[model samples]
Structure formats: C-alpha cells, structure tokens
Target: MIANTVRQFARVQQRRTLSTSVPSGVRYGKSFGATWLGDKGAWPVIGIIGGALVFCGSFISNKIMFHPDVRITPSKRNADIRDWR
Candidate 1:
C-alpha cells in the first residue's frame, strides 16, 4: 500500500552515520517473526488485561458517569390534558 511506498522513500532519503556491518564470527540469530501466540513473556498478561478491560469498560464508565437526568413532564397543575400529546 501507500504506507510501504512512503516507508521505502523515507528509508532511501535517510543518511547513515555509522557502519552497520556485523562481526565476521557472529552467527545469525533467530529467524522467526514475533506473534501473540509465540510470545511467552508479556503477551499472555497483556491479552488477559485487554480482555478484562473490554469486559469491564462499560460498567466502569457507567459507574463513573452515574447521574440522575431530570426531565419536565406534562401535569394537571401546569399542562392541559389536550396539550399532553
């Protein structure tokens, strides 16, 4: 998409100040890309917290915003029956 094209152009326009060459004796590290399933450290806790947040959000919001909204209603003292509708 356009995002990739913009990233490509931005990278091409960037200047390097230091050599990025790796040491000759160093072997290539892990080849796998990151995923939620593969994550054993933070992902599990993050997912539980995320789910809990979604589940509890409405309740928390309603409690925090709790207020009684008053509305004027037609009554015999101030309003005629014919004008009630």
Candidate 2:
C-alpha cells in the first residue's frame, strides 16, 4: 500500500511540473498604453476636447432651458410668477 501511494504521488508531481513549464517561443514583455490606444500622447488631448465639449454642451443647454427670463408661456399668468424671482 505504501509503495502504491508513493508511485501515485510521484506521477502527480511529474504531471504538475510538466504542465507548468512555459511553452517554447513564448515571449513576455512590458505592456504600454500605445498598445491599446494607438498613440499614448493623444490621450490627454482627447480627454481635454471631450471635457470641453461636455461642459459647453451642459452650459448651453442650461442657459437655454432654465434661464429666468425664459418662461413656459408668454402670458399674464406666467408674468405673475416673476414676483417669486
């Protein structure tokens, strides 16, 4: 029984060592942002342009939709609410 257990353990250890070995011709190296983004330097410019567009869009939309002078209807009922301002 002891000999059978030793043989089984030796076979398992051998299989594990063989499976963990790196395959031939496989190269590992450091990764850079350029690998995914095409150009690492352009990220900052892209971020700035995107941020500016978002800010300007929100600002314009707010000014058009929520300005105090702009009312839902240009009638006396709407004008009566101006006292709340």
Candidate 3:
C-alpha cells in the first residue's frame, strides 16, 4: 500500500556515497559503538537513592496499614519465645 512506496523511496536515499580509507590488512565492519560512562564513579549516589526509597516505603507501610494496632500471631515455624516479651 502507501507504506511500500515510502520504504522504496527511503532505500534509494540510503545508497548515497559515504566511505573512509581502510588501513592495509585491517578488517572493516568489525567494530561497535559504546557510551562515555566508563571510568566514572557515580555508584554510591545511585545506591544511596535506591536504599532511601526502599527504607521510606517500608516505614510508610509500617506507619499506615489496615490493622496498625492489632498484634499479629506468629506462625509455628517463626514463633519463638525470645522474639516476644
């Protein structure tokens, strides 16, 4: 339909000349592109932000729930006298 006509027109334009001289014994089309974030040190900032969000969310859930004042009975596997007063 109309899509095929636009694709054919674009293909004609892609055939324009664009080249660079290659060194002797060097292979072409064997390279890839990369970003510029290498050697940068920003991991601490990212980790702090993520950890703060998780802590805030946990605090909010503990503060605002359907049964905030109710005591939850522990399951048999997790029930230990030392965990209770």
RMSD of each: 14.1, 10.5, 11.6
Q: Rank the candidates by TM-score, best first.
A: 2, 3, 1
lDDT of 1 by residue, 1-22 (tens): 9999999877866633224655
> Candidate 2: lDDT of 65?
80
- Colliding pairs, model 2: none
**Model 2 — TM-score against the truth?**
0.40
Model 3: clashing residue pairs? none
List residue ranges in candidate 1 displaced over 4 A.
1-34, 64-66, 69-85
Model 2 misplaced stretches (Cα beyond 4 Å): 1-36, 70-85
Residue 66's lDDT in candidate 3: 36
Tens digits of per-residue lDDT, candidate 2, 1-85, equal 9999999999999999999999864545625544436667878888999899999999989986878766655563446558534
Lowest summed lDDT across 10 adjacent residues in model 2 is found at: 27-36
* Local distance difference test scores for all models: 0.59, 0.76, 0.57
Clashes of each: 0, 0, 0
Per-residue CA lDDT of model 3 for 1-85, tens digit only, reads: 8999999878776664333434464545554222222314655666788899999999878765534343454453355443333
In candidate 3, where is summed lDDT lowest over 10 consecutive residues? 31-40
